[model samples]
Target: MILAVVGGKGGVGKSTVAFGVAAELDAVCVDADLGMADLPERRGPDLHDVLAGRAAAVEAVDESGPVDLLPCGRTLAGARASDPRALRAALSAVEAEYGRVVVDCPAGLGRDSGAALAAADACLLVTTAERAAVADALRTRELARALDAGLVGVVVDFAEETGPLRGRFGAPATALPESEAVRRATRHGLPVGEVAPESVVAERLEEVAALVQRSTRSV
Candidate 1:
């Protein structure tokens, strides 16, 4: 299955959640944010190369990381050269080889974000408690529905009040409190599970992952 981790607004810890869920699912996480790749930077043929037709999608996956990742190029030139429309095929190829893929989509309602949603079998929305963030997430949810990607779950970052979100999103909502361990793990491009397995943040991530798994199965 291909799961797209999407947040309409940036800086909501979407990439961190994507990486953590990928780690829990033992799936390859694809940094589909071509313009602003947030996951780890690795040395090899990245998503940019794959989308630019310079490399095979499977060949660009970096397995040396804590979690397998298909990193994206950081250069603006590379991003420009990449075809957003090719993302679906590339993701499909990766899923074929790896069995599962978690895509960290770029923020907003742009073509890049749309492409990721279009390619995904289902999506998990990530947002914050702020009204603006929730509004944007609502817009994202509409986009995902339009693209035919089932909304499996929602992750509310740095917030403990999940009951309202569950009703608003009509999906299971998991709260991820702000944590130094998560911050430190993200700074090093490692999943919280790897950085602090015994921490509360890690336990919450596991819950988020389980919610996604069950939701997707029903889908």
Candidate 2:
């Protein structure tokens, strides 16, 4: 299964959620945010190199973390040189070998984000409980439909209240409470489960992972 983890807005913990889902599922997480990558950096070829025709997609795989990663470059030059259309081929290679690939897509409906959505079998929308963010997620949902991708579910990160959002999206939404463990895990380049195995955040993410798994199985 190839899943694209996307957010309606930046700074909503989309990448963090993506990494956690991938780690829990033991899938490869690819930083598809070529221009503003938030994943941990490694000293080697990345998604930018793959898109720029400088490196093979499989060759860019970095297994030095809890979950395997295909990180993106943070430099402006790297992002500028990347070909958005090349992402299809890049994703194909990883999906072929890994069986499961979760792409941490950039925010908005831009070409780069579209490319990742187009290549995904399904997508998990990430957003906050705020009205504007949920509205933004609806736009992303439309884009995913345009690309003929299925919607796995929605993940409401740092959610303190979930009442108003129930039945708002056509798909189910999981609310993950704000937790300090998420911060520590991200800072240390680890999954939330590793940092806080007994935390509510981790348990909620496990439910999200199960939701994704069920979606894949149904397909």
Candidate 3:
């Protein structure tokens, strides 16, 4: 399975949902969020090398014992509009070697997100309860739908201040509480679920992961 996790805005925990879902589904996670890649917070081969023909996608992967993270390293200027063919081929190579490919797409309806989604088998829309964020997600859904991308679902992050609002699209949207565990783990260069497995946010993310996996199977 190849899934792109994207939204039209940033800081809505898009990486959290991307990595969280990969952990739950036991899939290979790629940090396509190159501009602001998070998997590299712990250090890994830079994606810049891969894009520059200096490295293979697998060479940039970090095998952290439980799962492998394909982190994007080294910041680049024109990476946002990079050709989808290269990214697709890179990811396809990894898919042949792993169980699944979970792409951590950049925020917004830009070339980076579009290229990643264009190469994905499906997409997982990440958003929060904010009215503005919801609108952005809807526009993202439209773009994904236009490209004929199979949508997994919408993950509503930071539900501590949210309602029971479903996604603008018809897909299911589940909310998780915004907890300190998430903040602490991210700041310390660790996966939130691994750092505080029993925390409220982590538990909720696990459920969200399960939902994503189930949706994948249905496809």
Candidate 4:
């Protein structure tokens, strides 16, 4: 299954969550965050190279899971616009190579993000407590529906809030605080389950993995 994690806002921790779930399941993360390939900085071969045919998918795989990665190969000096046809071919190669492909899509509703979602079987929508972020998420969902992709989860990360006050948002507006732990892990190039084993983020990632497993089984 190709599970893509995406958000309207940049800071919502989509890649971090991607890392977490893929790490837990021992699955590949196809880092489609092309505009800013953070996965390579933390862990990878820069998928841009793979897409460009400069490298093989196996060569780009991060081995974080037993999991491989197809890092964004497009470069800092690369074209501003992505070649959708090329990306599609690359993703087809990736999908054939891995058991699970978790794509960390670039934020917002744009061609790059659209290309990533178009390749994915489903997506995990990441959101925040902020209203604008939620609106973006909703739009993202609408886009996903239009693309006929399944939505697996809605991750609500709250890295900013603290203490008991943070608990308020947990029940209604969010899924719990995956934000804080994920932030630390992503910054350090570690998966949340690895960086903070007991964190809510880690536990949530486990749940997400199980859900993915179930979905794949059904398929």
What's the distance in Å from true for residue 141, model 2? 0.6
**Considering only N, C-alpha and C atoms within 3 Å, which residue pairs clash in candidate 2?**
none
**Per-residue lDDT tens digits of candidate 1, residues 166-205?**
7999888888889999889978879999999998879988
- The Cα error of candidate 1 at residue 183, in Å, is 1.3
Q: Please give the range of 10 consecutive residues that has the lowest summed lDDT in model 3.
A: 75-84
Q: Give the candidate number with the greatest lDDT.
A: 1
Which stretches of model 2 miss by more than 4 angstroms? Answer: none
Candidate 1 clash figure, as a count: 0
Query: What stretches of model 3 exceed 4 Å from their correct place?
Result: 42-44, 77-84, 161-164
lDDT of 2: 0.91
Q: What is the C-alpha local distance difference test score of each model? A: 0.93, 0.91, 0.76, 0.70
Expressed as tens digits, the lDDT of each residue in 34-145 for candidate 2 is 8899988887899999999999999999998788999999889999999999999999999898889999999999999999999999999999988888889899999999
lDDT of 3: 0.76
Clashes of 2: 0
lDDT of 4 by residue, 21-63 (tens): 7887777777777677766443544566665556666666666
Q: What is the per-residue lDDT of model 3 for residues 44-151, given as tens digits with 9 covering 90 to 100?
A: 555666766767887777786355788776456635433445787888878888858889988888877788888887898888878899889888988898877787
